[model samples]
Target: FQFCSTRHELGSIILTTNLDFDKWPDVFGDARMTEALIDRLTHRADIHVMNGESYRFRQTLELRKRVAKEN
Candidate 1:
């Protein structure tokens, strides 16, 4: 929170999270602080939401198939 507060408009910040904004409070454990942090971070930010199958999951499935074939 301090970092974001300090750099709110002075620099650029790139953040990526699998969790949604609504779920952030669960991680931060403080609803007010979470809201304030998000507000500061997103005040002038461009947001993007990506939805697709995970690459790691696909690779894991392929590895399992290969192991099954070997057995």
Candidate 2:
């Protein structure tokens, strides 16, 4: 959390991670480290759980070009 810590003592910081906070232990390795790290993070922060596709699969530039050609 080098990046997050930089923002600490300043104001709120946002974590737009593909991995959930619950999975952070496995992601970071060492649950204790994860706990301590997240503890500092949660002291005054907003946690948003966002899940969705890759976006490219839903809408692509190739498809947009083809649609434009038809028009």
Candidate 3:
């Protein structure tokens, strides 16, 4: 929180997480802290919620199917 509060304006940061803003407290284990952290992080951020199965998992299944066909 300290780094973000001080350095957020210095540059952009990229983060990936499955949890929504409302669920952040579950991960942080502190509602107040999560609120503060979210406030700072979202102040100048582009929030994108990605939905569905992970790309890597889908690709792995495709690879396995192809290998099975060849064998």
Candidate 4:
């Protein structure tokens, strides 16, 4: 909270989170604070939402297939 507050309009912050805004309270443990943080972060920001399978998970599946074939 302090970090975002200090850098609210002073600098640029790149934040990447898998969870949605509504689920932030689960991680932050404070609904009000999470709301404030989201407000400050999105005030003058360009938001991007990327939806797809995780590269790591896909790679793991490929590795398991190769291992099973070799067995």
lDDT of 1 by residue, 1-71 (tens): 99989998689899999999999999999999999999998988899998998999999999999999999
Candidate order by decreasing TM-score: 4, 1, 3, 2
In order, what lDDT does every prediction score? 0.95, 0.79, 0.85, 0.94
Model 4, 1-71: lDDT tens digits are: 99998998689999998999999999999999999999999998999999999999999999999999999
- Decreasing lDDT order of the candidates: 1, 4, 3, 2
Segments of candidate 2 deviating more than 4 angstroms: 1-6, 52-56, 61-71
**Residue 51's C-alpha lDDT in candidate 3?**
83
RMSD versus native structure for model 3:
1.8
Candidate 3, 1-71: lDDT as tens digits: 77877777788777788778899898879999889888888986889887889999999999999999999
What's every prediction's RMSD, in angstroms? 1.2, 3.9, 1.8, 1.1
What TM-scores do the predictions have?
0.87, 0.59, 0.77, 0.89
Q: Is candidate 2 or candidate 4 better by lDDT?
A: 4
lDDT of 2 by residue, 1-67 (tens): 6666667767777667777678999988889878878888988777777567767866787788889
lDDT comparing candidate 3 with the true structure: 0.85
Clash count (model 3, backbone only): 0
